[model samples]
Structures are given as structure tokens and as C-alpha cells.
Target chain A: MAKGLDIGTMNIICSEREEEDVVFTQQRNAFLELDSSDLTETMLDSAKVLYIERDERIYVLGEDAFKFATIFGKDARRPMRYGIISPKEKDAIPMIKLIVERVLGEPGYRNEVLCISSPGEPIDLDMNPLYHKKMMEALARRMAYETHVIDEGLGVIYSELSDYNFTGLGISMGAGLTNVTLAYLATPVMSFSIGRGGDWIDEQVSITTGLPKEHVCATKEKGFKLGLEVEYGSADGALSIYYDALMTYVIKNLNRKLAEVTPPKVEFPVALAGGSTLPDGFLKMFERKLREAELQIDISKIRLAKEPLYSVARGCLIAARTHEGEEIGSGGETEEGAG
Target chain B: MDNTSSPGILQRGALIYYVGSVTFAAGIALLAVGTAFITISRIHYGSEPEKIILSVISTGVGTTLILTGINMMMKQTRYGYYIVGASAFISLLALLIFTSNYPHNWFYPLISYVLTLYIAGFLALLGNAFANVILWMIEGKPEAVVGREREIKIYTDEEIERDIEEATRKSIELSASELKFKEPGVEEVKLGKTFRETRGNITKVKDDIGEAKSLRKTINPGERMKSGSVEVESVSRNLGEILRKGAVQKGRFGKIKEEIKDEMKKFYSSIRVTRNR
Candidate 1:
């Protein structure tokens, strides 16, 4: 049983690992982060597994419920899913039980409330009205309090503060989605994703090289950065394809949004956050590509989070604190009529 | 979803190679059938031009097969290249034997023999190249997608209050004389020493990770940790510092208002169901 409730925010990165050949889109650089990876893993880790596919990629999400002969854990088992319901109702039982245990920490937790957060835009723009609420409610059953969102641009705020105001683009990269938060006025103006983040990168690298995803990741860890010619002809040039494809969105879709956002007072910069952005120089590559496309954005102004991975979660904490009537430090100009 | 073709230079090249090899093979097979028909019946398969076309058809079939094989080979098709190569060689050898068998048929046989030999050689090379191309295309197993989701829990109302309280204290840079120590649940007691000054000395009191092991150790004496006597100031001296720094002011007009409102909602929401109970 876990006592202290661990809270975090995840800017879901739609890496190559999560999507197939096709890259997912970054929703207005909206954040799709979560409080913990544990809750997601629960529905996915155990027995029954299910997935969803939208926009050419497959998503293995909702884990099935299972008869809990008594199962629990603090560390991850493997391969948690998120899309929809698992094979059987019972498949999700074990995971749900673990969520319960983690929040309540043993028998005294039958009704301890749990609060979670989501990427700002997706939850708001979900075509399915109940899609998000249902997902949050499903989570609520395991814990007590369930909050889907902390506040818009919450994570970006923490990231900007960490980076001394977007000297660079702050990317909250994750699996299934990637959120880009661009801060110029020491606050986020807008963020968008080019899809094909870490997961897709991993998957493409493995498939193209005949190597396992884990091996590729290990190699990436060893500084065998993608976009370079590998031992076998760049495995059909995954990185080249990835960058060209993804950058198009950054150029076409996101650039347009950036143009539209007329910042009134402050000049924010670019910074990156999230696990996907944790890789060394991902920000630089993105910046370079954007520049090459003649967007002519200044790369020197880019800022990387001191701890790229934890920025989003910490931002959620900031969000939580703000909700408590506590003060959150300031940076960017506030949008008029924004609730 | 960004709907764009994966069609890049290499993909386009591969597609062109595929189409070429397939058409080449189909054409050669037709040519081979034409040759077989004429060879079996000694009759002109068609008019003079038609007979030539028939012969060309057979030659084309052989050429297509050879080309397809070679393309596969270029793509690193281990087996396809070998098979194509072998078949092309066999066809060449067969053409050689047949042409040679018609000894002394003069110029026509010689020309025919040379043509057959050329077809065989070309086909063999084509097959080998195609095979290589196909093999190279074998990137073996495709990679799998790895999904990641991180979850963090929102604090209950009481926990939020505690965090806010602690954060407020930490925010202030206080003097040594202004510090005090407060004890459990209620009441503030001043202890003229600053927690900051004693924090290095306060190492024995582990930060409240609330671990079972720590709880066990605290209960036991061998660990030499603080017992019931451990205390810190309840009223943080940073209160005045907050006013000076204006964190409150910044948080209010800037981002903190939204953040506070959000957290307060979560806190109350957590308390909501429990109150119902």
C-alpha cells in the first residue's frame, strides 16, 4: 500500500513508439499530461488488453478488469494501455485495485479522493462529450477526488519559470501525444505537436533496423541519436522522414497559430519540457527544422528545462497550488476574455 | 492526423523498382511461351514480323524474370536473388543446348543461338539484382509502439493546506532570532533557533516520506532518530518576507489566482464525498 500520493503531469508524447508509420498531431501545443504513469499502467499492465486507433496509428489503452486474487505493485510491470475497455471487465480489476491501494495506502483508503490532470486542449476539444469525463470518472472510482485539468498552460508556467522564460520552445513530449508550449513573454503563448515523438521514433528505429525497441532506446541512451546514418543505411532514413513529416506540422499548422497569437506586452521565448524533449538536442533539431523552412525563428532564444521530464508534473503541482488560492509566479501577458 | 505520403526518395525508388520488375517478368514469360510454341511446331508463329515479335516476347519474359530477381537482390532478398539467378542460368543453358543441337543450320541458327545466349545472360543478372533489392528491403521485424502515461494525485484539502503552509514558510528568508518551534496538531511554541540554522542539524528527522521502514525505525531506539520531542515553528517568520517579495501579489494578478481556484476546487471535491459519508 502506498501512503504518500505521488502527483505528476505528463505532456503525452506521441512518439514513434505509440504511433505506426503515421505521426499524430500536436493539439495547439496543448498538454495531455497525467498525474502519474501508474494509473495509466494499471489499466494497461495486467491481463486483458485493448487499443484504439485514430489517424492511422493504433492505441492500446484500456486494460480489462480481472478477478483480483489479490494483486498490487509500486513498480511498473510493463506495457500499460490507454484507449478503451479491455477484453473483460475483470481484466482491469487488478489495476483498479492497485490504484486504490496507491492512493489510500491499505485498508483505510476505501474512499480517499484522487485528482488527476489532462492535456488542456484534448480534454476540452474531445469530440466525444463523455469521452474525457468517463475516463476521469473511471479513475475516480479507484480514488476519491478526480480533477481532469488543473489549469490551462499550468505545466508550461513551471517549465518557463525553470527555463527563465521561453528562451526556447517548451515541448511537453509524451507517448500518444506531444504538447508544445511556446513562451515568449516568460509565459506560454501557444504550443503544438508534430506528432511522431519518442514512441514512433523508437518503433521506426526498431522496425527499420531489425532491432528491438528496447535495444534502440539503449542505443539512443548511448548517444546514438536518430537522424544520423546508422550501421545499416539509416534504416530507411527514419529520422529524415520523421523530421520532414513532423516539421511540416510545426511549420504549417503551428506556425499559423503562432502568427495569429498577437502578444500584447511581453516577449516570451521557446523552451522544452516532457520526456520526449528530455533527449539531448531534440529542441535544437526542431528549432533548426523550423528555421530551415524559412520560418526564421531564433534558435539562440531556445531554453531547455533543467529537468525536462518532471516539468509537466511540477507544473500540475503549481496548478494545484494556484487552485488553493496560493500565488503562482508570473511571466506572460494574460489573454483577454480567457477563463 | 497529418495525411501525407511516406513517399520520399527511397520509397519512390523502391516503388519504381517493384513496378519495373513485375512488368519485366510478365513480358519475358510471354516471350518464352512464344518461343516454346514455335520450337515445338517448326511453324512460323506468325508473319515474318510476327515471328520476330513472338521471339521478342519469349526474350522479354526471360528478361523480366531476370530483372525482377536482380531488383529483389538489390533490396537484399537473400533467397530470391539466388533463385532468379539459377533460373536465368538454366534458361541460358537450355537455349545454348538447343541452338547447338541444330548444328550447321548456318547463319540463322548462329543468330538464334547468340540471341538466346544474350537473353539468358541478361535474365540471370536481372534476377540477381532484383533479389538483392528485395532482400535489402527486409528490415526484418517491424518495431512496436511503446506507450507511456504518468499519473499524479491531487492533494486532499488538509494536504493542500499543509503544502501551502510549508511553501509559505520556505518562501521567506528569515533571521535566526525570529524562529520558533511548534508541536503537534495545535498551538505554536517559539524556540528562538531558526529551522534553517538547525536544518543541517535536523538531518536525523527524516523528511516525512511516510515510509513504513522509517516509521518502524522511529519506533525503535537503535536508529537514534527523533522521538516525540521533535518540533518546528508553526508560525513561519517568512510571513513578513511574503509581503516584501510580493509573491502573493504576483500570484494573484498573474497566474496564482487561477491556480488557487483550481486547487481549492480539487480540495473541496475530495472532501465532498467524504462529507456525504
Candidate 2:
């Protein structure tokens, strides 16, 4: 069986086909460090919180880490920031490795093809994704899986725009980065990322409202829709402001990038997928921004992925399946049988 | 051989060229029919995105093939082979897109027949290009080919493996020192002696003093003590020299500081004198 792994800043999701159904497993990509003690260890055990012990310290992982952070009034440390491994977080590598392992589990078979989604080099940041890509590859190889890296935005296209003949624009508004891909008939014409996303919104809102970033994030995720009115100094109101700004930034870059490349003169159906796009009216807000920008290329429609968070994983699955098919065609064998 | 020296259009090369041309024309006709089929499907389906996309792709491929075919026939140069090769690859890609669109419908008679026809057309296009390449190669290395001659080499598996091993060996030799330097996990302190030697020397010096004390019981205690004292004095003298060298370096630093202070004093006095004036 082939697998798809989406290593996002906020989450690590794995998608695989089991029999006739597709199974998705996920974990929040955050951890909280606590001083290791017998009492605390017993408490964690009683709570059944996922954690690992190293250097005499306990790291609470996944969603439980967020809960722990909230209870302690501390910030949850993320393994990634701005779509890549955080340089400031010393434990980013080990933390991400453990989370990916938990999410992916053991491959169905040895050397199973695992297609990983990697963000493109951000146009606005002086960051290179090569090291991160190689690190993910190394992790996958350590798990005895053959790995292939797919552009995160292109993965979205494969997941959502198959019916459009894969000719459209796919944008993943993730937590740390927004990836954009222009694909024509399954071929990526151009792809890039911006180093601003949900986390940026949370931070900006936090700064404006004098609230903790974690508190702001919690408020934003607590089912507030975009374009909703709230108290002037409230978290939701600040969130709305930042969300608008983020949309404007994305649309402006879209215009600037589209001007540099001549895409085929066809109306493109844009697919938005990621955690950031989950809020209600995100598509409507993005559509408004795109209309205001008045890009040269025609846009047929803009829609959200059915499962925004799982879209990249699903795309990776599709890509892995394609690769498996090619491998089978080339007379490669598996333990069970030829797929 | 000169072109005039060869038997005219009745030659095998000419025959293959004619056959390629005919096959290409037939393949193009089939692609045109495929486009029409796509259009009909779109009409029946109320212009669905997938059908429309398929129609556009088929029409585009059909148009490209026609243009390339005209270019090849009119130019009649080896460059036509290049165009044909590119078109053949594109047609195969188109076939892949077309097949993937309705993968489950391959069992349906209409879909199966259309797919078979498309495959046949693609093969014909590919075959035409292959035949043209053979004709070009067989006609002789013509002067009008207009480029540097190309060389194609085929290596056996063993030869390829040997070459790779040779390259790996060279790379390993080149990077040996880099790998060795990088192996130390922590930053190494550069010193005149290895840590082990420095540690062993200190222990040996202590052992020598202890041995001298032990010898005092067997020999003249005063003489043994004098020899041990001489050894200690020499060691202390070397340490004193090192300390003296460090003091000299510190003195140089102090001298530079004193010079700076004097310059500051002079500047301040000059300012005071001007103020007084």
C-alpha cells in the first residue's frame, strides 16, 4: 500500500487506502516541555497524554500538548514555523520526527511509497526548503519507505481539481505559509509560497488585542466566521482584520506572479485547501479580494476543499498511487502481490 | 555517397518516407475524429468541465499535428525528425490524459473502441517518426544535416557499475579529509599536543616526583632530594617563561591603552586651552 504524508506547521496528517476506504490519521504539530517528576509522570499517565521523555524533561505532544499549555498558561512550542523547521526551536527535528512517526505509523509494507507534501520556496522570505525536504526524506527513509516530495499546492490541485482536468489554481492557506500552484492538465506551470498564514493572523491579532497568541488562536478556532462583527478590542474582531489583510496580501501576490507568467487562456477554477480556509466565508472573502485585484487571467470559480485539512494528504495519496502504478508497470514486486 | 548517386524515389529510404507520410496522414485523421467524438460527448453532457477540457486538448493536439506535418513535408530536412519526435511524445501524453479521464469505462464497447483507435493513432505517429529516423540514418550522413554529429553510446550493466564505483572511489578520496574533520561532534580545541598526551605528561611528571621520593630511602636522601628539586626547578622555570611571555603580551596591550589615554588627555587639554582663550 502507498501512503501520503502532509507535514504542515500546525498538523501532520497521513492518508492511506485500506481495503476500500481511505483512512486519515492526524496529530497536532505542537509540544510542551515539562520538568519530569514522578507525580507529573503519574498525572500524565492517568490523563493518557502522549509524551516522550528526554534529557530528564517530558514533552507533551499533539492536541494534549495544547490542552496542557492552556492549563499552565504557557505557549505550545511548534516543531515548524513559517512552513519549515523552526530554527529557533532546538527540538524541532526530534519533535517533528516523533509526531510524523505517530501519525504515519508503520508503513503497510517495507519500502512502501510515501509521497510527502513540501511547501515551495516562499517568494517573500529568504528561506530555502531544501534542508527541510531532505530532512523529511531522511525520516521517511529511516522508516523504510520510499519517499517522493510533492509541492504542497500541487498536491491540493491533485486532490481537488481532478474533475477540472487538473487545470486550475490550487492555494493552500496553511498555518505558517500559503502555497500557490498554477497547474494545467496536471503539469505545474508555476508554484510559490508566501510566508504568512493563520499563525500570522493569530500573532497580529494577539499584538493588536494584547492577548496571548495561544488565546488568540483558541478564539479564532472556536467557530468564528469571517466578516462577523464583534467588540472593537475583541479577539474575533482583530482576527477579522488580519484575515482581510492576509487575503489582500495573497491576492496582490497572485496578481504580481500572474503578470510574470503567461498561463493558458482558460478560466481557472481555484481550489482553496488548508486549516486556515476552514472558517466560513473564507472563500467569499478571497473571491472578493480576487475581484478587487482584477487579475488578467480569468477565474471560473473559487471553492474550498471538501476536507480542507486532509486535502494535501489526499493529493499525496493520489501521487503515491500513480508512482506505485508506474513501479508495477516496470515489473516491481511487493510482498503481497503486484498492485 | 552523393544524392545523385543513389537510386531515385524507388529506393528503400524513399519508400519508408512515403509510408511514414501516409501513416501520419491517417493518424491525423483519426485524431480529428477523436476530437469530434469529444465534442459530441460534451454536447450530450451539457458542456461539463472534463468534457470541455478533453475537447480542447484533442483539438489542440490535432492542430499541432497538422502544423508539424506540414512543416516536415515542406522542409524535408532532418529537423523534421525533431518535430516528429516532439509531437509523438505529446500525443502519448494526450493519450494518457484521455485514458485517465474515463479509466473505469474501458470495458464499455464505445469507450474501448475509441481508446483502441486513439492508441493506434498514437502508435502510427510514433512509428512514422521511427521510420523517418531510420531513413535519415540510412540515406548517409548528409552534408545538409546542419549540426554537430551526435554520438550515442550503450554500456552494459557491468560497465555502468564499474564506472559508478570508480566515480564513488574518487569522490570518497576527495572528501575523506572533510568527512574526518566533520566527525568530531563538538568543536575541537586546537592545541600543540593531543589532550591524551597533555594529560599523560602531567601524570608522568607527578610519577617522576613520587619515584624520586621513593628513591630517597634506597640512596642518599639529600642527593635524591636535590635531583628531584632540580627537575622541579626546571619545570617551574619553563612555566615562568610562559608566564613571562603572557605578561609581555599584556604589557603591549597596556601600552596601547596608555597611548590612547595620553592622546585623549592631549585632546582634552587642547579643548580646555581653547575655552580659556
TM-score of each: 0.36, 0.56
Tens-digit lDDT track for model 1 on A1-339? 111111222122210111112111111111111223444435433423332222332223211111120123121122222212222333242333233232223222454222233433332122321233244345444344323342223354443544342233555555434565555433445544444345566677687768666455445545545344434455335544554465465456556555644444544455556555554556667767666665334444556665565455445433333232111111121111211
CAPRI quality of model 2? incorrect
List candidate 1 stretches off by more than 4 Å. Answer: A1-115, A120-130, A137-142, A146-148, A151-153, A162-169, A182-195, A226-231, A234-248, A259-261, A293-300, A325-339, B1-277
lDDT of 2 at B264: 45
lDDT of 2 by residue, A1-339 (tens): 688899999989888775446677778899999888888877887666777766678888888888999898878899999999999999898779777877787777899999999998688999977678778887887798988988999989888886677778999999999999999877887788999999999889878889988888877777988885767777778888899999999988888888766799999999999999988888888888887788878999888998898889888887887666532222222112110
i-RMSD values for every candidate model? 28.8, 39.2
Off-target runs (Cα >4 Å) in candidate 2 are: A326-339, B1-277
Candidate 2 Cα deviation (angstroms), residue A339? 24
Candidate 1 matches the true fold with a TM-score of: 0.36
For residue A39, model 2's alpha carbon misses the true position, in angstroms, by 0.7
